[model samples]
Target chain A: MHAIQQQYWAVRDYLSPVLKESKFKEHGRITPEEFVAAGDFLTYKFPVWTWEKGDPSKARDYLPADKQYLVTRGVPCLRRATSLAYTDADEDAERLLSFGDGSAAGGEAEDWVETHAGRQSNADSAANPGSIDDIPDLDGDGAHEDEGLSSAVGNLSLSGAKVPDTPHLDDIPDMEEDLEDDDDAAAAPSKAAPSSNTVIDGSEIEVANGNLLQVRTYDVMITYDKYYQTPRTWLLGYDENRTPLIPAQIFQDVSADHAFKTVTIETFPHSGTLQAASVHPCKHASVMKKLIERMNAGVVEEQKAQRKSGSKDAKKKWMFRRASGNGKDDKPLPDDEDVEGMRVDFYLVVFLKFIASIVPTIEVDSTTAF
Target chain B: MPVVQFTQFSSLVQPTFWHELTRLKLEVLKLSDASVPLTAHYSAGRTIKDRNTGQEVALGCNFTVGSESFDEKHSLPPFAVVAKGIVKNYNTIDEFKNADKRALFSQAADEIWDSIEKDHDASALNRFLLITFADLKKYKYYYWFAFPALVAHPLWDIEDDWKEAKEQFTDKQLLSLHGHLEASTTPYFLVRPAVAGDGVDIAPVEDYTSFFANVPTDSQTIGFFDPSPHPSSPGWPLRNLLAYLRAVHPTTTSTLRVLCWRDTEPAHESGQWKSRFGVLTGGPAEGKPSAVGWEKNPQGKLGARAADLAPMMDPTRLADQAV
Candidate 1:
């Protein structure tokens, strides 16, 4: 323990003089190593939050207010915080859409946007409570698109030619109101479709205005993108819940264009678009398959033994992150019965590695905060 | 120093094996965009050819309401034509109260939909609506899709398809029939990794949206993309969508129509294809997260019991005054 503290001080003391002077600055800033030392001492180690409030120290991360953080192993893990901390569940709900409310919220009020600026509501139409039929019956009105061209969503009451014969007419109960326009024909699918079923967790993953944050249960959802053949993540937020923040809070200042740029899975033919709920990574399942095959066959244990004896193959094994000495989560998770747990670890590990590269001005104490 | 493995062989379970993910969560909004009713006129789209492969692809109808086509005749060709004929006009009408503002900002979303309806008849993209929304206030474009094209799911029987591809109707057009009356359904927000490889061209935002706001002062911003397994896909569709989004609209608050179906009712699979139901459930790529083997999740089996937790959690850590 003393050695660890000494090592920490050694690094900090070496860098602090230069960092505080600002004379060693390159490009008007200190290096990551410098920032790591200076930040820890000035912000974290300083316990300024306690002093500012004139209270006993309450760990540096949980700020005075509206600034929360995740507590892992009883310590705040900002690395994971960079990727995912708090989630404005409402934002996630806003992104998800059910077929039934497609028009009321989708066509009318535009709430589904990856916001960069503040909450920019739709300028044109407010979210309508009324269903399609409730909108003034456009029995004869030409409407937005040409009535002749509006084969699907146009004038339900007027466009008799295309309206009566729609195969799924029975499925649409609302169309019955406008059917008065095409009273002549109404044969449809035999069965009334099952009742609606899309239930979105309106727990805001992030706020619409993105000003603050909340404690997150599930911050981001990742999925395999077969189209791009990579893992796509939905960056719901990076909230630790130390404080209540505006629903729309970003982790750092990364733009939605960069942070929320995600993979869209068009369940073609299914008419279902399932985007990964968060910015979790997608690895080729083959990697895990290979590892699982080895684990199932007990090859990994043998490799571990060989690695202890200094076999060269152990050095080349990329299956376990070859670069990190602390093992995953600093616990040396060399083997486990739960292969699935290992798979999640694999992604978390890789995702943490990727985030470290993007976070830019921080000295990484360990590859993963865990 | 040693490598940290991603697969616990256990931390997370194969979600496929878990009971079907029936309930999806979402945020619901009723779209009442007054501008949607604007008349969109279309002109003929151009046929673009790949520079290296010498292959030609057709761009859907370009919405040029009361204007001439500004098709690029001469250009530094990219690997392939990502998207064609999508334009957002940013001739910011300096409050020309006399000008037909609505007509000036008409959308090509429907035109793209019409073309995709024809182009992606039997394909996956067919089930998606690559949409462009124009917010007259911001003068920026935001793109979205009424997607999750689940039309031709392998599971759905041909005759019993919710909406058939054989009969060409856009996803939204088909949605217009079903989405309205149904209550409780919400679209879930999910994302995919942008898969990039050969034949995938994620063009710069300028390549497509530049022509929309042809003014010298006009600028555009591009969004990020996901890696996909398929090649030469969505590049064109997304480009076209963004083209209109960046040029014409005040903002691209594009919303997608994602169906969030909960558990599959037993009746859905009881008919002819009852046997086919468990292929994925019983097969690989499915299961729930569990600490112990088969302790939870009816779908999982006790292939191997979990190893000791001593190794999974850190065995060495001295805290406070020392244990």
Candidate 2:
């Protein structure tokens, strides 16, 4: 049964249309060339990350020898996952995610993305507790409203027709309120997340009491997945003493929601014998597509707002704080009118934002101000 | 006074190190079992006290090496000591096991002794050797680590109880010392309070004779980047340094203050460094000293540790099991 499914997946993946355009709005997955382009863009924006060469024996023929993978080393992780109180609500959202293998039977990519959107709302609510009542009800079959676009083969642009149906995507007022709350939360780190458990091992306390000055640091590397056809991120963690953390210990650094399910210990393709905790790339495309759609919806909302307010300069603030690549200036982009979607180069920056949600404590993503 | 016995170093060979070694084997070495130069690191691990004895337990120091060890330009952490080591990769397990273990160990020890005695390279005091056989086909690796220390005829005796670093120097002085030591490249060095005032002055171990020329013999302090967490005894790297010291200053019988410099966190000015100070009195014989050092397996027996990385390394098995 598994072999048959594997054969089917292989066949479908083989037949999946190669993305010719740079934008990955339709499917999160990108061609190898697109992955290289995105990597170059990420490296250009964040000098901390650089393209590194892999072992010659394991080098893929398709990728350049010097640019086989992207690496950012010694990214500090202040605390453990246990330190972050896990709310039952977060677990419910985690269960809603479809992070299974990339089999065609795992349902439509749009449906998977819709569920992901629902989970992100829950995550958003978890971050901003005051907006609990304002969250639009996502119960029943009304959740997967847009069903026509789901497919493994095609480049049907997500923003071609109407805006995505996610309520929070269009709700500018609530998003602004959430941003205000986020800035407040950033100022006062105590009330940052709506955590339930009283097990708060603050970084200062850990350093003061336990003499744990050397916080665990991780090396984050992104490699292109051949089968999943999306970029897969791998983490290699070092403990306070700088000893490599085993897979089990590495899981402690990951958010409880995606610990063992979404993350797996596997041999790094570039470095043959080395194994690391990799964020599974199965649902990457779906998640990326949903994020891109939400980004477009955000722009459309801004465009509407700009039209209503009659502001001379358009503010293209990237939806996310960390993923605000080249959007930090808050200036109107030259291609603001083209608002077709985020350029494909921003795929990795957005992907990193998604990863930051999973590993909230890792500081690598913040190296680039954008 | 009790005889001070140093704790041996435990090897923490990271998987990335093995992966890099495998890469070098396949791409660079290619069936040629040659010695590869490697620089490892060791720091003072956490100090744990025995609940029953109420005494600080001597934990084996850890000497670690990883992917960065292959990068010659990689800068080490401030608290870490550059432990010079060599990797002898064997093509097969039989060759690794059946090889003359004693001969290889003695040869490594002899080279270190020559560096210490003839070349007078103080940095050679932190020499170690590793032998590995990476069975790439099976995704298994058999390895052993050795940290050679020349045996002292009369093992040094601790003349006094260990005192915290804060006991001897103020926080300001320690901060200055920490700052100075952060830039030190060699593991063994001489540290003393500045002649004029507030901070401390540090000089390489090779400048020992000149460093102590003006200072009172009673106040001279010798320090090394100690890797052990033992509250009473220093780590293994100190033994060779002590041996070299005694050989150089044979006629002088004045007590030498030894600093087990264990900076738990050198990056932060927590002033919570776990360093200790104790005085030692004794020395080894003048002639060529015999060396002994071979790390035991986890079970406390002399054997190589084997790691089966197939579950994590095999791509086919991983893919088949993934869905």
Which regions in candidate 1 have their CA more than 4 angstroms from the true location?
A1-248, A251-302, A306-318, A321-370, B1-159, B162-323
User: Candidate 2, residues B153-217: lDDT per residue as tens digits?
Assistant: 66677776677777777776677777777566458878878887888888987888888888887
| lDDT by residue (tens digit), candidate 2, A1-370 | 3346546755775576654554467777787787888898888666557887767777866678778899876566655553454555555544343544433222333324221112211111111111101112234464353242223112322112222111121211111111011111101121112132222212222223333322466889999877777888999876543445545456656675676458777657777457778898888989989987887676655555544555433323444222334645543334445433455677788889888878876765753343
lDDT of 1 by residue, B139-159 (tens): 122221121111111111112
lDDT of 1 by residue, A123-146 (tens): 111111111121232356555544
Top lDDT hit? 2
TM-score of each: 0.21, 0.57
Note the Cα lDDT for every prediction shown.
0.23, 0.64
Query: How well does each candidate reproduce the native contacts, as fnat?
Result: 0.00, 0.10
TM-score of chain A of each: 0.22, 0.57
Query: Least accurate stretch of 10 residues (summed lDDT) in model 1 chain A?
Result: A123-132
